[model samples]
Target: MDQLLSTDMDLSSAETDQRIHDLSGQKQSGLAWVKANVKEINDWVDRDGFALLRGLNIVSTNQFSTILETIFGEQLSQYIYRSSPRTALRNNIYTTTEYHADQVILQHNENAYSNCWPMRMGFFCVVPAKTGGDTPLADSREVYKQLPEALRNRFEERGIMYVRNYGDIDLPWQEVFQTQSRDDVEAYCWKNDIQCEWFNDGRLQTRQFRPAVMTHPQTGEKVWFNQAHLFHCSAVDTEMPDSIGADYLPRNAYYGDGGEIAKQDIDVINQVYRDLTFSYPWQRNDILLLDNMLYTHGRQAYTGTRKVLVGMAKAAR
Candidate 1:
């Protein structure tokens, strides 16, 4: 694991040479060397929002977890209040996402839709796809700068309200909340400011209003930080059947007051993401670290097996 095979997504290329650090060398020097450069590596990620670490021996999930904990100085935080399907390999490291091979997972700041989110995240590409299975990234600060002033103003004024229904087409209530007790679910929701309603048919509906933009505590920079585009009817309809009414959809986003956002607005937001998002082919054994608030990550559709593991920490409210 001494030499690095450059991938476009590595971000260690000429323009971003500082973003990649070579950790492969003598057998005994790798992890110790990383400890010495912690501040520098973190600085690179802080300045650029993400960085690629080359030549690491991250061959297993536990090894990945150890590296992440060693760098961040904390055990990986549990993926509580989960939104997507993922299998826990061990040590809180998880499969990034379990969506179908051909379905594209939209870019999102980890747990951004919730009141609490992981501030730091790390990803390891244990298995690269045959062709297109890159974990593309976007700088949220750039996203904020590129968005139209009017659109920003509207979102700022209204915030973002996410309405999620659980039962049939998506995750069940127990899985989303990670518990079976209704009382426990209510207690969790009460603590998180999420309004949860239970139906007789064993379904649950939840609504929460979160700010569309967030100020990074460390950077003092504002970022586009909500998942409105991913939850809008237009995007959901792309995968869901047209016959499914918007009301019955698994999730949807609206203005804070619950007013419908104009379709054109969602289109513009999605288009901006299209213009800004990018990825290089993933190479096996590549590790990527991100300042979650400063960046958003997405997955590409691929034909073969693609395995990426995640370790998230630095919880912030």
Candidate 2:
């Protein structure tokens, strides 16, 4: 599963020749076409941390899954959004949705709450909404660069404390998976091999903890792993009697109320993130790949029916 199947999907003879001609003056590698293409792909990833492999006609889910494993390694299952037969129709009906990182963005790496790190993370948009659902990426490195030294030292020293209240809102995901049995939730936990404390007060609620920072296994880059969603949303319960949103704090960590962090710092980080953000309006058949580690993305609500399919892959170490 880790090794790529040498697919016969290479370009035609003329196409390869043309590509070689285009790169004639450039640094030439021994293996003419494929090697050169590989170098180009690597170069793009080196510069931008991600690449958009356009017009990939992935005909089936199995093929898609194989492709992701080939490219990113074996961690695709942890993050992949396995599309259903009705995925196209369902995505169309829910024409718009707000943006946020993965569920565990609220948790630390796979065992930061338990003792693991995610191998890789990615998403493939099968059908993009009509408007306002652009994938924006902000470099964490840049976000860290803009952090005040004192705040950095505080986070580096004390780290962050995160808490989540799933009881507050009936998230779409919760509802989608909610069943009379609560078995689905239990099954998910079991499959992931993580210990959990579950509740069923006419619904299921779960809480988990993780570290404030993570060290990337390959690059040794340390990423801020504070579960902003929990801290931000929890912190707001203090000053505002009635409000809901993600927030954080450098001082008290998990003060405030309802999981909201601090409004001021949240705004500052959001704005700083906005500075590093890049946007591409949704196109009919566009396919985008993301480096979940390097960039954080969000979505905006939109009108008109939109359909999107998503595939998450692991990152190659």
Give the winner by lDDT.
1
Q: Please write out the lDDT profile of model 2 over residues 96-189, one tens digit for every residue.
A: 1222211111111222332233344334555666555555555566666776676555555654443333343423225433343456666764
- Model 2 gets an lDDT of 0.41
Candidate 1 lDDT by residue in tens digits, 162-279? 9999976878888888898999999999999999998887878899999999999988989999998877776764646467777778988999998999879987887677677877
User: Residue 237 CA error for candidate 2 (Å)?
Assistant: 10
Which lDDT value does model 1 have at 112? 86
Q: Residue 106's C-alpha lDDT in candidate 2?
A: 17
Q: lDDT values of the candidates?
A: 0.81, 0.41
Q: Please give the distance, in angstroms, between residue 259's alpha carbon in candidate 1 and its true position after superposition.
A: 0.5
TM-score of each: 0.92, 0.59
